[model samples]
Target chain A: MALRRTCLAAAVLLALPAVPAAALPPGDAQRGQAIYERCQACHSLARNRSGPRHCGLLGREAASVAGFSYSRALRESGIVWTAASLDRFLANPFKAVPGTRMGYAGVKDPQERADLIAFLAAAGPCPE
Target chain B: MRDTITSLPRRSFLTAGARSTLSAGAVLLLAGCGGNKAAMAAAPEDDINILNAALGAEQEAIAAYQLGAESGLLTKPVLDLAVQFQGHHKEHAEVLAKTVRDLGGAAVEPLARYDFPSGDLKSEADVLRFAAGLEKGAVSAYLGAVPLFAERELAKAAASILGDEAMHWAVLRGALGENPVPVAFVS
Candidate 1:
């Protein structure tokens, strides 16, 4: 009876979707640099344009950039940039923050998103 | 002498003697006044022009939403959402027109008919895409206009409208099963 119960539990576990050991896939920063070209239309490493500068993106709070106008939704959103957070945001930004001013369609490819995240992570740390 | 000065008709007196000289002097006087007026009006004139352009775009948005609402391609929540967005555009148009009037400019009227891609709007998805495209264009246009306004208040108002347009664009993209906010910034 115990053996049958264990087998049932194992089967149920197997039936569930596989959870990845890591939230993000292995990314190539080099490839991500190329992907970052699309972001250049609004963002820059040094100065704010249509969007805020991205030099210190990782570990930064959303809408924290000085002097850049941000949407009320993003300004109120208590999001801190992290690998997992960025992965989700890069996948579907509007879903993550409903009224955010970002008009992008999101990167659907997990690998590409991972690569992009990696590139941003490597861009630099948050300013002191 | 006083009787003669008072009895002479003003127009006849000016025209009877030295007509060419009087005409030239009058022209110069008018020209001087006109140039000064133009200089003083230049800033507001620019704001009015920008406001009129914004009004025209808002009118276009209202019409586009009307088209989507009547297309039979949308149903339920989507139709309702389209109507709501149309209301927003109407409000935008009203504000823009009023601002133009306040600035002493004639607000531009909407085109009798817009040249939307009617051939492409065959399905609900197509309609959504069309609306999304317009919203995106509106966002970009407002972004460009925000900095051009001489009135800081007008620039702020435009930025506020731009935010609304960006939200609409995101919602339309969401309806299309696309990532609504794919980018970290609106370019």
Candidate 2:
């Protein structure tokens, strides 16, 4: 019980507002910029439009968006987005983080995913 | 909640009144001790009932995958994936059972035989479709329980499980010639 309590506390603290991080190969900012349009519906770099803001996604912990009422699952998931992790997650959001609430289906094409990841990675730190 | 399991086929293996006595003992212990009220509320009859129901559903899911694997309908890649999915269900089952125990509640035990209502497994498509249906059911069950857990932390656990169930549902749906990520939000 003590161990469980400590773990839960750690999870809660990690879920608090933090930075974002990701890893990806050098990508075509122009192509990635175009591909990123698909994610505009729910995600915006400036605000929590529909999903959490992607302003400073790189170097941040998963589900750490302050003031956003994230699904309990996403908040509790011990994940930090990186190129590799985000690649797997973006390929299948439900698979990467089963309880996450990012409603987008995911970019199936490898090139498309890479381009998008690159753009998001370089998008810079978010401030919502 | 043990009472609810009476109708479940797996309960037959246990001696009659065993669950009843177990529940009764747990209740007495809880009633006598000055336990945490919030915890007790978190494990209320309805919540435990939902947990048991989820447990039963997951148990059924594991069985379905096992049965599918044994049917010899899948090839190399398909067979490997089927086993991987089965492992997922097993993990879900373990977490669920541990949650039940943590809540000081009774859980459904694995039975010798589970009668999957979905009829005969004739072809590969039939097996995939059957497994898909079960995953869908899991999504439904866990999603429904997310709001029912009185304890906030338990709700988080339920939500986590619910997400995985939704993934399974979506992935399996895609395997059957359907768009994998068909929807954004799955209720």
Candidate 3:
């Protein structure tokens, strides 16, 4: 009887759906805009400051800006900006790109990182 | 030359001054008891070690600036700026040394010489770039150190120093005709 019950429980457990690993919280662009104040010190959506412009950061190739100088590490990275890649990069820029010149310590909080990414996604592409 | 490159910002100095004063007061308060009691209340071992590391870096910065100043690689206005930044590092070292002593730790002393890339520092631009790189590293180091302190006040003091270092980096970069503040965050 004990063996039968154990087998039944194992069968039930196998029927459950798998859960995703490290799922990020849903981002709010408005909240992200507020959090972006810290970023304003070096970045702007339309113009480059200390860092590259953010107007079309999402889906943009790393170090593709025409005139801005990029660190060799990033220029050679062959990165295409996406939510997932940006998430990792924004979490820790130094760890993500060893020699990238983005001097930011990175956004440590996941939700904040999500929101900032959302804001960038919503910021629209750079003007032609 | 841009004002940013020619002189330290007044507000940055004022903020550093106020924070240093507060930090000094906190150290004294921590050591208010007699010598034996104060000894018993020393900061955690890790904090002292970290502070000592920061002090060593500050000392190196002082030495590096002195070398640049004496090398005759910098122009008049740029040399003046380097001296001003060196003064800031001196103030930082003084505060760190005092805090270490107040916490019953022996402060780290400056070395007689530092191994800077002397061969590369042939021009004014080269020296400015080297100084800027050091300042940038200092900013990153302080950023990493700020969170590791056992005492919140110590963290705050480190952050204050970090801000000053960032400013120096920015000014040096500007002097080099590069963007003074390239990133929103110091890594």
Candidate 4:
């Protein structure tokens, strides 16, 4: 009877949406770390290296990344870089910004994109 | 259905039917050779499609090159640029053919006859106009295919090649005393 009750409780939780860690896999934070290397070319996690210092990029306004020459189209357009928006843009930059200079065609795999997103989420928002 | 006919063995009947079927198969195989020969003579199917588009672009370029070569509109320096442009197109076809082969695909041979613009051949201006149109079409075709390719490397390679085509357009347009970028952005 106790086991049955436990199974029933698990099922109910699984059926719900917007559970913080429920939908996400226990992603290898290490793999996510490695994948961030590729992104480092155009983005910087420590300090603004090539384009923008992406340390606390999450929850930040897309237009406000400092010292980067963002396309005028992107700067004027009010798109914020939340987890969802970042994933969509990483899938295809051209689709996200039709005429912007980010020429990457995007990583196609969902899990990889997810892992990368998770890494960015962990990176936290940039220091004000 | 006579009982006397049933006395003959099933084995003989099966053997006779098999022999007749085999003969019929052999006859059909011989008749199908014409298409097979043509297939052998021409390129493999996949490469043919890629090159058919490529060949059309190269032919247009050749026409423009010849015009640029013959016209006295430009000095030696500009004429040299025209020659280099023509050479690249010729080499592009060769390299693309090799790429198809490296990927285990066949390369297409050019067709015997092609119909190009016959309306005007009188002046340098007419030739430049034709060249510009050809370059525009080639750029369009290359850029159009970039999104269609699914493979990661192939998509990047297509984009890289498309960039060259764009440069060619810019160069040719400049040669004709037109702006390299008449329009600001290409989406």
The number of the candidate with the highest TM-score is 3
DockQ of each: 0.02, 0.02, 0.02, 0.01
lDDT of 1 by residue, B1-187 (tens): 2243235477775565333322332233223322234433546655665676567668878888899999998978999999989988887777777667656667777777655656779988998887887777677667656665555556656777888889999999999899999989764
Instruction: Return the top candidate by DockQ.
Output: 3
User: Which stretches of model 3 miss by more than 4 angstroms?
Assistant: A1-128, B1-43
For every model in order, the TM-score on chain A comes to: 0.80, 0.76, 0.81, 0.71
Candidate 4 chain A, poorest ten consecutive residues by summed lDDT: A12-21
Residue-level lDDT tens digits of model 2 in A1-128: 66664575465434332323343445675797766655542345665533567878877887898866565556666668777666767765544554344533456566677787778888888642
For candidate 4, give the lDDT of residue A59.
77
Stretches off by above 4 angstroms in model 4 are A1-128, B1-48, B70-75
Kindly indicate the candidate among 3 and 4 with the higher TM-score. 3
Model 4: pairs clashing at backbone N, Cα or C within 3 Å: A44-A54, A56-A125, A56-A126
Alpha-carbon local distance difference test for all models: 0.68, 0.61, 0.71, 0.54
Q: Per-residue lDDT for B36 in model 2?
A: 36
- Candidate 4 lDDT, A48-121, residue by residue in tens: 42245677777777658655556554564455776666766666654565434443446566567678777877
Task: For residues B1-187, write the lDDT of model 2, one tens digit per residue.
Answer: 3343233345543444433333333333333332335665643654555566567667767877889898888877777878887876676667667656755677777656654534578888888887776666456446545665554444555566667666776777777889877667653
lDDT string, candidate 3, B65-106, tens digits: 999999988899999999999999998888888887776778
**Deviation (Å) of A61 in candidate 2:** 52
- How well docked is model 4, in DockQ terms? 0.01
Indicate the residue-level lDDT of B158 in model 1. 75
